[model samples]
Target chain A: MAPVVERAREVRYATAAELPEAIVGADVLFAYDFFSSAIPDAWPAADALEWIHVASTGVDAILSPELRASDVVLTNSRGVFDEAIAEYVLGQVLSFAKDLPRSWELQQARRWVHRESERVAGTSALVIGTGQIGRAIARLLRAAGIRVSGSGRRARTDDPDFGTVTAQEDLHEALAGADWVVCIAPLTEATRGMLDGAAFRAMADHARLINVGRGESVVTDDLVTALREGAIAGAALDVLDTEPLPDDHPLWDLPDVRITPHNSGDFVGWRDALVRVFTDNFARWVDEEPLRDVVDTSLGYVPTDGSAR
Target chain B: MAPVVERAREVRYATAAELPEAIVGADVLFAYDFFSSAIPDAWPAADALEWIHVASTGVDAILSPELRASDVVLTNSRGVFDEAIAEYVLGQVLSFAKDLPRSWELQQARRWVHRESERVAGTSALVIGTGQIGRAIARLLRAAGIRVSGSGRRARTDDPDFGTVTAQEDLHEALAGADWVVCIAPLTEATRGMLDGAAFRAMADHARLINVGRGESVVTDDLVTALREGAIAGAALDVLDTEPLPDDHPLWDLPDVRITPHNSGDFVGWRDALVRVFTDNFARWVDEEPLRDVVDTSLGYVPTDGSAR
Candidate 1:
């Protein structure tokens, strides 16, 4: 915000109840933490709103019916998360394969337990969603010698990064033989609650699931049941249906589950990088030029056309 | 042992005290935990020992003065541990970079802290030892997009795995800017206690050290002091000078040190793989053919000549 203030633009910062008055004369709105519904509640006062930029990849929270019906240009920060999230996925995968959690447990007990671990090389990974984040995960995992397969909304056979991407309908078959099932798909009607009890049953008994995408994409109750029943080996979740995971959440107490505070894509200097992306896009917006990372509002994300504009 | 018993050969299993009588007419001796020094004590009674195979990569335990003076061939299970140990190194590297240890600590406290992590890609790693195990670590770390440099007994510029292998004389120079210092060198008189207090002080403040090769290669007292004073960030030690690390050891109580019971090279099926190496060599011995993984006993490990044999 200080950097934006230095740009000689009048910026109005307001609370949820004060947003309506602040948005009355604003031509552009920067929705930081767009997951909050305060922006939509103040939508009627956005009379001069020409563009709305979200500081996140997922726009499900800010996608109001009125905004979708309006002519306001919607944009998101897309490429900012690729490498960071990919590193998180690899970290969790290696942790499970090497049993680092158990190693820590033994360390705390002062027990010098010698246990044989599993190797990551030659193991199979089924990465759901072939977007920039998913492709990044596949690339890094492949480098570590994991046999990577991807699944997207439509089957893609020509992707060099994710070999022979299976169609979304065939996800179950892909799940059967995979040693890891990583979900990085965007949240949408088609993807919500996609990983239910049946999906868990389709996965190998020794397979582990990693969710770095939206929490709504997985059925939390079903995951708990699967973990309790020993249907899958374990799960490492960076996102959940509820933020902070609620202090009383059963997921926190589960021995087979590892919870991270929805921070998979965060790295040092992330805020500066996010600000840079927005400021660069803001420059183009002010000059009446086509903006970069323009989200396709109909699809709720930027289309994979390999374009920055 | 079951496979050897089923080979239709006369086999006598005995304790270290009884090994002399058992070795009277034995053509082959399988020293499965030869570190006990009992084999050397019973060496006088081995009248017909032609070959001895140690079920581990390190030949230090069985490198007795009498054995070195004798004509008996010595071999070790080399290739079996290369991949498993490499995986272990990578797991620790990723764990440190991603702050998984801190994440686990937060989980235990039920604290949902969102801390930014460091990126592994584009980071620098200095891997000591250019043998098969070191090469394997370099290969995997390189695959994960780390800038990997290696050190060996003598500098070699033609190596493909590590760009330019640094000589042992310049190891401290190699440690100056490295984000990770991985010691996978064999245990030899020249390499023992190579990583001392001075070496730790030369490392970057945020650098982490991983020792999977041998405990004696690093000075444990110096490492503990370094960790206490924050000379280096942390360390993950799979090999310690003492096996089972004694319950009262100070290393066990250090928060910055991660201790595993010298099991970095251990993986599921490792024992079976060791037996396979021995049984395969046994067939060669029976046919009067050269054995595989013949250790250059003078050097304490197999000399890397780019050959599987």
Candidate 2:
């Protein structure tokens, strides 16, 4: 925000209610966190709004019907979270493979338990998305010697990162052999509640699921049931259907579930990075040149051209 | 053992006390665990012993005075543990970098705490050994985007893994900027008790120490004091001064210290791999071919020619 205040031609700071008045003449809208029900009510006032930029990769929260129907350009901070989210996924994978939680449990009890651990080198992972974040996760996992396959909306036979990118329709087949299933796909009408009870049942009994995507991508109740019934070994979810999960949420107390507030891709100075991404895009917006990370508002994400598959 | 029993001209099985009688007519000795206090007493009876092989990497446990002075060849299972130990070290480093323990604590209390995590890339590590295990650790860490400097018995300027390997004498200088200090050097008179109070003091307050080398390489009491006083952030010790880590040891209860019972390198099927390493050498021995992983007994381990540096 400081960077933008100093660099932008004009910066107007206003609350949700004040946004309707403020949007009357603004050309660019930088929706930081975009958490306002007032956004739609204020949408009629954005008469001169030429572009809308979100500080987050997920634009669903800010994608009002009016805005979606408008000719205004939509862009997001896509590449910014790539490496951080990749590292988080890798960290969780290694934690599960090395059994770090068990080690801690033994440490607390003053026990010296020596158990043979699984090797990550020859293990396999089925990454559920072929976006930048998922690609980054695949790259890092491969770098550590894991066998990685990716799944996208469509099947790809020529992917260099993942030799054959599995189609979303064939995800269950991939899940059966995967030691890890990482979800980093974007949230959209098509993807919401995609990982349901059937998906969980398809996964190997020893396989672990990691959700760093959106909470709605998984059916929370089904996940709880899967973990309780041991249909899958465990899960590490950074995102949940509800933010600040309710005190009585069964997922919170499950021994096999590791819950982290949706901060997987966040590192120190992330806000600064987010601002930098927008500022760079803003410079392009001012120049009327093509912007980076422009999203297809209808798809609710920056559609991959199957290049990174 | 199954492979050896099938291939050997004669396979003799005996307890430590019975070893003296069994070893009299044996040409090769496969010391499985080699736990006998009677090995030195039985040395005189091994008139026909031409070679000795141990199932474990560290030969210090089986390197008896009489055996070292004898003409018998000695070898160890070196390459077997390289990848496993490297993965263990990387897992621990990621655990610390991601603050997984804090996340777990927050989860246990059903708190959705969001905290910024540190990035592993662009961080520095000072690996305190240049041997196979140390090099493996450095390689894995570097793969994960860390700037790694290695330390060995002597300074190496031509090492490819590390630009300029620091000598053991200058470890303190390396420790100053390191986020991770991994000790995987062999247990030798010079390396024993190398990481003392002064060494801990030289590290950054947030840096962690990972010891997968040998327990005696660190002064247990100094490590306890350092961890207790927060001189160092934490430690993941696979090796401690005591095996099975006496239930009453303070290290067991230290919040920051993660203790694994010296099994960091013990992966499933490790025994089979160890035997394969020995059996491959045995085949070479039977054919009058030179053996692999031959140890220079006078130096107490495989003498590196600075080739791996």
Candidate 3:
């Protein structure tokens, strides 16, 4: 940001509350606190704003109807979180399959009980998102020998990463055959509350859910019921509807549930990486060249047809 | 074993104490608690023994001077545990990279502290063995986007799975470059106590050691010293110098040590898979065809040239 600071006529850094005034005459805005919901309120003040670049892969947080209807172009840090989140998701899957949490507890007690672990090779995984992060996870999991399928907004027969793309509409039918269902969809009307009790009920008794997507995508209470009733085996949630997930939340102590702080994609040096993405895009903006990761705000995501990679 | 019962004149199961008498008239033996040391004691009674099949990858427990000198053929369940151990190793690597154990502790206390994690992709791994299981691990890690190299009995500039395999004697030099050191080598005179004090000292302070191979390959005291002095980052040991490690062993309370009872290769249905290998070999033996995974007695492993998959 320092290198590009001199290029702007005036540069302003502001908190969510100060965004309205800060965005008044700004031609470009960098949403550093990407999850901040002040964008809608500040939208009326973005008088000369032509572009808004976010330091996150998901644009749902700032994608308001007014901005989508306007001429302001939106871009995101799309490719940045792909590998990091993919690695995180794979770690969770392996942790569950290998019974690592139990081993940690047993190690604490100095217990040497040898348990038989499941092999990841032949097991199947159903990735709910077909976006870059989801594709990265599918590739990584496939490399680990897990058969990977996908459930996206639309069904496709020939996806390079996910061999069979099941339509999100038929998610329950797809869940029945999967050993693990990974939800990595963005937050949208259709995606929110997608993994409700009924979806969990459709999963196999041994299937586990791994959610690294938006917290709002899953119905928290319904998920709690699913885990309690044994409708599904367990879950590894990196995001929650309410976070730092209320210290006294039921999910905190669920038997087999794994709760990781929403830092899956925040790998070491990620801040620098995010800045690099913004600066690179800023350089393109100054040069009047094509920008990268432009979001299709109407869809509340960077559509696959766009230059997503 | 029951299916192959009719083909043999007699099928006998023997404990270490009763093995001497049990081997009196046996033509073939299936060494089932593969780590059993009773074979040498029962050797003299195995007058008619033509072959010995082990239910394990490592034949160290059954390999004896007499058995090597004798005409008896030695075969093992080699391919059975390759994928299983590879997945376990991958899991351990991910577990370490993602700081999952700490997350488990925090989750226990309902604490949400977001920490940056390392990326597994693009990081390098030094796989210390070019055998079947080691090869499997190399392939899986490579699939996860990790750069893989190997250390074997001999060095090679160009190899299939491991591009540049360092000689076992130059292991210290190789230790400096890898983010992860995966030990999956078979135990032999050269391998025993291989990872000693000097070797640990040569490794980068940030490097981690994962041992799925024989425990004797690593000197316990030296590894303890290495961890204590920060000679190396940490270790995840699936095998230990002592089985059912003493309740008060130093490793139990070591900050970064992960101790799992030697079950890295034992996945669900693994016992059945090992049996299938033996039964298939038995059927071949009855038909007078070449057996699979025949251990090269002089080399103490199924030589790479000996039809090893």
Chain A: TM-score in each model: 0.96, 0.94, 0.96
Q: Specify the CAPRI tier of model 1.
A: medium
Candidates in descending lDDT order:
3, 1, 2
With a 3 Å backbone cut-off (N, CA, C), the pairs that clash in candidate 2 are none
Q: List pairs with backbone clashes in candidate 3.
A: none
Among all candidates shown, the one with the greatest DockQ: 3
Q: Candidate 2, residues A78-174: lDDT per residue as tens digits?
A: 8778888888888888888888888888888888888998888998999988888888888889989999998888887788777778888887888
lDDT, residue A49, model 3: 93
On residues B83-126, what C-alpha lDDT tens digit does candidate 2 reach at each position? 88889998888878778888988888888888998788888989
Highest TM-score among the candidates is held by which one? 3
Enumerate the chain B TM-scores of all models. 0.96, 0.94, 0.97
In terms of lDDT, model 1 sits at 0.86
lDDT of 3 by residue, B1-309 (tens): 656755565788778899999899789888875445789988888999999999898888888899999999999888988988898898989888889898989999989999999999999999998998998999999999899999998889788888999998789999989999999989999899999999998899999999999999999999999999999999999998789889989999898899988988889998899888988898899889999888998888998831346
Q: Model 3 over residues A176-206: C-alpha lDDT tens digits? A: 9999999999989999999998898999999
The TM-score of predicted model 3 comes to 0.97
For residue A307, model 3's alpha carbon misses the true position, in angstroms, by: 6.2
Off by over 4 Å in 3: A306-308, B306-308
